[model samples]
Target chain A: MDYGWLMFCILLASWLGVELIAKIPSQLHTPLMSGTNAISGITLIGALVALAHTHEPLTEFLGYLGVFFSIINVFGGYWVTDRMLKMFNNKNNRK
Target chain B: MNTDIFYVISSILLIHGIKLLGKTATARKGNFISAFGMALAVAATLWQHPPQNILLTLTVALTGAYIGLLMAIKVQMTAMPEMVALFNGFGGMASVAVAIIEGIKLNYIPAIYYDTLIYFSLFTICLTLVVGGITFSGSLVAYGKLSRKLPTSSINFRGQEWVDVILFVLLLLSAYMWIFTHSVWSFYMLIALSFVGGCVFVLHIGGGDMPVIISLLNSLSGVAACAAGLILFNKVLIVAGCLVGTSGLILTLIMCKAMNRPVKKVLLGGFASISKNKQKSTRGTYKPISTEDAYYILEAAQTVAIVPGYGLAVAQAQHAVKDLAQKLTDNGADVFYAIHPVAGRMPGHMNILLAEADVDYDQMTELEPSNARFGNTDVAIVVGANDVVNPAAVENPDSPLYGMPILEVFNAKTVFVLKRGQGTGFSGLENELFFKDNVRMIYGDAKATLTQLSAEFKE
Candidate 1:
């Protein structure tokens, strides 16, 4: 894996993230924050790989914790974001 | 077939999802899209590289899912800020665990596999651990403040800036030592000190600055994930983490701009002295108004604006507030909610609470429009809001909150401030709006007070 290529991906993604998120209405900022927070749990991939193909007790335990916590973040963050967005959406429909 | 294609698909979904998340009509769908993207990323990883201790991974994953679902379903709306902070903390700890495990494998795994790993992987390892450590600890402290387990004020002392600088320098030294010498002991120090650094970092900022800290820590967690992605050589983590990192950073900047504060000032400049020394900057008399009398005044008003603050959320009065707003609308008052960008404990918290209470989304307004309409408004009902409606933000330059935008509630023909006591707001600064001739104080729990006002209208 070339360091330069990894840097390239990161830079491009960052620019796109900013462009995508710009001009959001203030009412949706909380949902936006929680949504992006859920996306941060993409680290679950790293955690999954770390846990896989391993049998060493101590390292395995560490990876196990990683898997547990990232899953919680991924699931919890998305569910919370969904609930909030639902509140906003429901209110719009009634009007 | 290159399995990396899964990562590519996941990244595309995330980018598209975030774009839709920004708009009003498509936010829910966007959230679903991103969640699906996350599921794909997780499935691809598990299918491609299966965990050897299958039972252990499955057990851990199931428990996490149950707890996550429970938390989402069970949390009260008032506690949403704390819930978000807790989730951020957990996300950060997950990153830390991932980085630590990677470091452990790098240290003990066979030298042949390590040979293929670049030396820079060590740097990313340290980066992930340190940033994740800071995010985890800082977010926990934030959660404590939001939950009222810790004092919401800045715990500042003399020369707080010097302490921060010295502690930061120590963290840098430990990271540099760990990277250069590849010593596990230095690695431990880096991890330990960053956690300490995190606590010290958040403790000196006032609670009013939470919107800034939460967004900033949110950004830090993303950067941590990016570093972890580098360690695992996972493109999905890199793209997703980098996207969250940058977007969170942008949100942080927006929150700071709304408060009219520089990022460096909120991050490092101690706020205790600023808030402490500026107490009692202005003084004026206030009038108390009974809800019974207020109902009469409201019956004749043609236009009204409701400015909600953190106190409204604390009292869980959104439902009662909605009732009152509906009653006012029945009386021919054109009522709308004025939302300050930095309101409640987090961004858009009041709006969520109001929406939860069934308030029409169309009736809510943002700062600039609300401010502009206050002059034409017949009545401005401030529900347990003080600092946000404070004229001190505009007129009293000596006040600590000077130069920050406010609801300009005083611009209305008649103003009513519902307060619990005569003391200044949580920021501990005097509110000029309370002293205005047009303003009257209604003292009680905001929910009870609003309920009474609505009952008065019901008659």
Candidate 2:
């Protein structure tokens, strides 16, 4: 598969995603932003691969740092988004 | 090859998860679905690649997750913006590390590589370095401001703008030198300059514009990740990166609309802090109304609209506001909440607060819908909201917020503004709505005032 074609498809898909997101109510915007932030943590895959492929000390150090930061981004973004969303109680649950 | 099929499935799930997040009732499920997809993607990647230092990888990941979880759970709702900033910074830094690794690896490849591929790889590394560096340090500055560790006001020194331009140009120069000379020194210099450029880029932005800056940084982090994916030829990374980047860009646009400014103006910087000098003008006098008077007027109104702002968030008055709205509804008044895109510090900040109070998603109206109904509304309550409802956005061309889109609350037959004091809003701009004949100020803490007003409606 050609890399250029893949890049084009990704760009198109992303545009569609944004169109869908724009339709969401303003109430969920914060959670949506944070949720996407969590998704951006997909760099974890690249980091792990870099670590596995590289044998040099300098590359290894960079790889470990990448893995560490990627984990923080993924976990923190999702958990905080979940906690915030939890606060949004349904009206039926109201006292 | 086996992992490609799994990656495709993972990408589909990610897209599905984001789509489900559009509505209120399904948002939590959507969040979990996205996490599930992320887990699957990570597992597939590791399973296929099988890193050499597995123990170290797992150890770092576990430790990072533990610390991240603790921070997420312990942070207060008021500090959410900073929490988001920290996560974004982490994402950016991760990309930076990945880019450096890829850049080093590229050097080991034989010079026989396809010309386009080599150039593309170099360009991607440069982009990842600059964008990721900016996102990381800028987000840190934003976190500092939000947490009050750094000055909330913009910090500028003489000739700072020129310094910023020079730093940016130097960053580009270093990237160019590294590409042509393949010098490790030039690469490290590029990294250092980018980090400094990132900090200087955001330090001058005041707290008021932090929300917009945060969103922009989020987008940059995504771009950085995408560049990293390009370097690795990882399909899933590319897909996820593009999704986040586009979404963040759209969000940034919405925020600019809320502020009634162009993207260029925001990027050039200093619009938010510039408003500080225009603080208080001896505009028209405001009419103050007691709670009793406010209650009397509210009881007779056939329709009511509530406009909320950051002040409402500061006072934690969403619950009380909900109670008042319920009271108004029970009395046979049509109650609707007018939500401006930038009503709170961040996009949907007010909506999140309202949702926490269990306000039905249906009753919350947007700027356009509420504005259309304002003329028919018998009473409009401005709960600790100033800038959004300010008539100055429309009527006063000379005002800082003159062109911003504001809630047309003045069109209502009667208006009551619940505020703490006579001070200007977060933007430090005077609201001309306060002086209009139809507007009345119910000066007090938002929660207390709403509580008192709700009590008057009790049988």
lDDT of candidate 1 at residue B278, scale 0 to 100: 42
Candidate 1, superposed: residue stretches over 4 Å from native: B108-117, B278-280
**What lDDT tens digits, residue by residue, belong to model 1 across residues B1-459?**
555998789888888899999998999999999999888888888889988878878999999989998999999988988888888888888889888887776666444454435467778888998899999999999999999999988788778778888988888888887666656788788889889988988887687788888898888889989989988888989889899899999999999999888998888634556665746655778899999999899999999899898889889999888999989988888999999998888888887888889887778899999999998999899987777788888998877778988889899999988888887776767778887899999998989999999999878
Q: Model 2 misses residue B415 by how many Å?
A: 2.4
Q: DockQ scores for all the models shown? A: 0.85, 0.71
DockQ, structure candidate 1 = 0.85
Whose TM-score is greatest here? 1
TM-score of model 2 vs. true structure:
0.91
Go through the candidates in order and give each one's C-alpha lDDT.
0.86, 0.84
